[model samples]
Target: MKKPGRLLGSVSAAAFAILASSPALASGTLAGSTITNTVTVNYQVGSVAQTATSASNSFKVDRKVNVTVAETGSATTQVSPGQTAAVTTFTVTNLSNAALDFALVAAQQSGGTAAHSGTDNFDVTNVKIYVDTNNNGSYDPGTDLEVSYLDEVAADASKTVFVVADIPLSLSTGSVAGVTLTATGREGGTAGSQGAALVETTGADSANTVDTVFADGAGSSDSARDAAYSAKDDYTVLAAALTIVKSSKVISDPLNGTTNPKAIPGATIEYCISVANAAGGAGASNVAISDPLPVTVTYDSGYGIFLNGTVTSGVCNADGAAGGSYSSGTVSGTLSSVAAGATKTMRFRAVIN
Candidate 1:
């Protein structure tokens, strides 16, 4: 569904709160009111604008900007990673008068670590920011990493940062991310010209925001972030957990004679791994299960089944060990969600030779 972009129509005084014992910071103390304005969302095709760019003239109001980072079919076309998806966009717009100067020191869009070229838009050369991985949003040196400045956003002009988040790579997504950006302005030497805003972002969407944009479609995500956070914020939140889980190991029969549950020769063993969302955090997708076929059976050359030529439910029974580079039977199963404490099991059997 294609919908018209929103102007963010309203602003709350609470959105900003600025104070100045010294009257040299900004337009106003930013203490009482708020400013909300229009911003053109740079989505691919089906993308929807969550809110208009909001800010404040009073330094006391402590202006804020909320943005949502997501994948679009293309920066030029669709909003989400449609059946066939392509581009990635990071949108930001300044609601203030003078042009906005976003100091980008370090940043990446799709992978684990970004290849920030010597290029202009992608390179976050040399600035610093306080990252609140804990979600406190406040900079805590003990808990946060002093990440360098990343890509910048234009003043009042909503802009998008493009990247490739798709899979299959010799080079990693570096660090998959819904990069949350922050810092006060610094293009100028004036007092509050580089002022800070109370910024918020949408959670990182799996593909697009349509399903995640509304409350009706959140499913497990509703509970994970399950908050009013935006796409960018969600990405930051889940990114932490995803980082931890990505480090988990997949089981495989080691050729080494060392461990317990030693590979038995000529014996069939049913392997069942039930993935449970042990903690109520987030769910993982595109999980690949791998294990070395037991040494007991040999894999059939033609069919890649067990040497004994027996097959069961998602299982291969034969002389325990399989042939031809450790055979694998299937990669089909959908665990819609492994909710907190909920488990999804994948079973594969190996026969002993």
Candidate 2:
């Protein structure tokens, strides 16, 4: 047969030059995986030698979408303007191999200028986002998983998300706010469906060598493969503004001296107490400040109980010398720090016995 028709056209031109110089075995496998190849052919009938084998087709890899976001805790937290700020966890991972559906959004960031400048603009109230469900990363309101988005993850699986916010009592006291959390990739619609398509680039093509399943670059919207993810956190607000004042003076008056003062039975009063702080506010740690002993007066202990006038009745300082503490009738003090507009004073001496 003309030497088997030139030996089948020299085995089809050597299998098209070994598949055009081995382009990675005809690229195509990963994603949903499947690749099988086999080929063999030898000829020499004149010498009674021949062999031919080839039959094995399988190459199907398509379906790739990725996602990853993290900020699981303590990215910076501390709040009290209306309270309720301590839950900014996030996990959302599904480096997709298949089975995907995610969509969740939350934003509240402003022109920040660092440390209490314009206070970084503010707006945080009620905001909530949940899905931890027993994975025990915390936030168990009714046994976890309260989805507003994100239904199926499986395929590298991972989902912890939680945002819970509320710091707006008029926010101000070193005010600061920034919170962003986004995760999108709702391929075929289902959870709150809205015609999803943040990913899934149509089998992604690079000349489609049998569909090589996006190694990044198909219809690539590139969010690391369109699974998309974003995360940011920060909330700071700590307020403190205090003020108190009380006064009385008419020292020594056996009956009525120091300008017609008469508390009867050997009078002698001198009670003052002032404690102020409120400039930019926020700075009043451990500051005690107590006072109680007025059954009509009768505490003198040699004219004791003085802080700024310093009789050393129990230490309290602000140039008032010593830190603070008094006993019995109570006249406590402990101003570890009170700056902001600063002011501290406490004096004592009474008798109407």
Write model 1 residue lDDT over 24-73, tens digit each, in one string: 53222221233332333343445854554432221112323222223222
Candidate 1 has an lDDT of 0.32
Q: Estimate each model's TM-score.
A: 0.26, 0.38
> Which candidate has the highest TM-score of all?
2
CA shift at 263, candidate 2, in angstroms? 13
The candidate 2 region of ten consecutive residues with least summed lDDT is 1-10
Off by over 4 Å in 1: 1-235, 239-269, 298-337
lDDT of 2 by residue, 1-353 (tens): 11112222322444446555744421222355543344445667789777764443334456666666677664466676777745678787766566567878867776565222334677787888888878879887777765667776666778888888878776557677777777776654464543355533453353224231323322211244445667667677777777776777666687557777866767887776766778876676677778877677777767555554321343333245443455776667665667776666767667876
Alpha-carbon lDDT, every model: 0.32, 0.62
Off by over 4 Å in 2: 1-30, 35-57, 68-87, 98-135, 139-156, 159-174, 179-228, 244-246, 255-259, 262-267, 272-286, 290-299, 302-324, 327-331, 334-353
lDDT at residue 51 of model 1 (Cα atoms): 50
State the lDDT at 185 in candidate 2: 64
lDDT top scorer: 2
